[model samples]
Target: MKEHHLKLNVLENSQAFLIEAVSKAIVAENDARNWQFAILNLVQSLELSLKSILAKKHPLFLYENIDNPKHTVSVTKAIERLENPMIGGVKFSEKEKKGMSSAIKLRNDITHHEFDFSVEYAKAQFLRVFGLIVHMFRHHFDIQITDYIDSNFIESLLEIEKSRVVLIEHANTRMQEEGVDSSLVWECSNCLCDSFVADKSKETCYVCGYQTSVEECGKCEDYFYSHDLRSIEHLFETDFCEGQTIVHNSFGYEPISICSDCYVAVQRDIDEQWQQRIEEDEYYHWSVE
Candidate 1:
């Protein structure tokens, strides 16, 4: 039990460091000279947080060779090992894994090459990096890091998001000038960037490199709100969809025609109910025979 507690402490501290790094990165994004350092710190935070997760399972896991004991597991090795369930590692979705790999690539580029880093690129990378961090925290630690983020950091991200939207709109305008259909335009839910070209059978966001999926509403036969859109709410919402009724026809349930507006209202009600239930459960501490 004490060992478990110690591991938890390490994880908590690692997460704290990660949050601090992200906050600093948001600030540095405003200044061209400081932005590179911010990227370095963010990458370092990712590596440390990932290792801490592996360490939580066993301190020996952090070591590359348990017998020789001279080498520690590298960030690349740690991320690769995480895919194997037998090693007590969390399973990452393909997109999440891809995002992590991209961050690693960015770190290498910045460290090894004469890289030309731009504010736009950094903003996109930050979204991907922080998105993965948020996922890992929830799945591995069962903690909400958004609760720990300060208002100023949130405001900074909002500003970046607005810029992203403008960039996307400009790109779309160029595509339209080239005779691309306007109906093929899709907004990226990850960065709130409207740079996705839906003309192809499969579409990906040009700005953030996030993949997009089109879901059809069962009632209207029109495109329904996507899981990516829900990701935005997950990032900003306090409870993270604790009781939200995601309009999916899973588990033999009939699909409903939930407009986006109606879905938002239903999600709000669900969140309220979930909060009340959590409070009641904590107060009662009910035990069943």
Candidate 2:
């Protein structure tokens, strides 16, 4: 058997490293909701550390002679003020504070009590906050050992695949209502050329007997394959479907087409429903543990 010891510190280094290590575990183990929290804890720890250091630098911070307490005087602003007491005038904006406060609340639940981790909420939080860390890293405020992966990569991949599932459920619903023929058509959207599902051969199209030379769509005045609605990710929509993981990992490259403008609308409805599940809050169950 093998064992490893881990620790969190508030005395000197702060608990940021502990949270970060847990985050890596969450991501690797496919525990998204938990991963979301690990990232948040790490960020909050950073903010707290910065504020503490700044408070030490500018001991008179709370008495900066401002008549009103600004909604924007959040942790980051306090940290900066310590570095340059002259700019104690600037503070964290309300938008930044709201995001941070939400993060704090979420982290508290995961850390102090048992909370059901919502992957979407976690993904949303990361997309909102990682912008700051990226900036700090780029400006040399933070040291880099190697290329660190961020949550956006994870969220984007997740969304692309989740969106595909939404599209497929919608197609099945349509098929049940009107049958397959109407639900499935592969004509070139640009030239209205009949699309054939066959091996890509150098030979001319058998339908119109059009060679590779005459491949242009007469309707759109472009090559039938030029507009190439292949841009539409149909992996989930057809038997030609690639596996979910493949499509998920590809991000936008695997975008699915909803066919008509109507189908797009239809798909949108289904997607919203699915998204609601991921984002739905259960505040009633306040027990963190």
Q: Which candidate is the best by TM-score?
A: 1
lDDT of 1 by residue, 55-142 (tens): 7777777778868767778888888766668775577777777677767887888899888656656666777787677677777777
TM-score per candidate, chains pooled:
0.57, 0.33
When summed lDDT is taken over every stretch of 10 residues in candidate 2, the lowest stretch is: 1-10
Those runs of model 2 whose alpha carbons end farther than 4 Å from true positions after fitting are 1-33, 52-93, 137-289
After superposition, candidate 1 runs with Cα above 4 Å error: 169-289
In candidate 2, what are the lDDT values of residues 1-289, reduced to their tens digit? 1111111122134334433633453463346755654565556655644443443334234333346534324654554564464743334466556566666666677678877644444544554454444443344335442345455644644563464356445544644464444312333222122332122342232222333322333223333333232233442333334653333322222344323443355456546655664465444345443
Provide the lDDT at 106 for model 1: 74
What lDDT score goes with residue 3 in model 2? 12
TM-score of 2: 0.33
Candidate 1's displacement at residue 118, Å, is 1.5
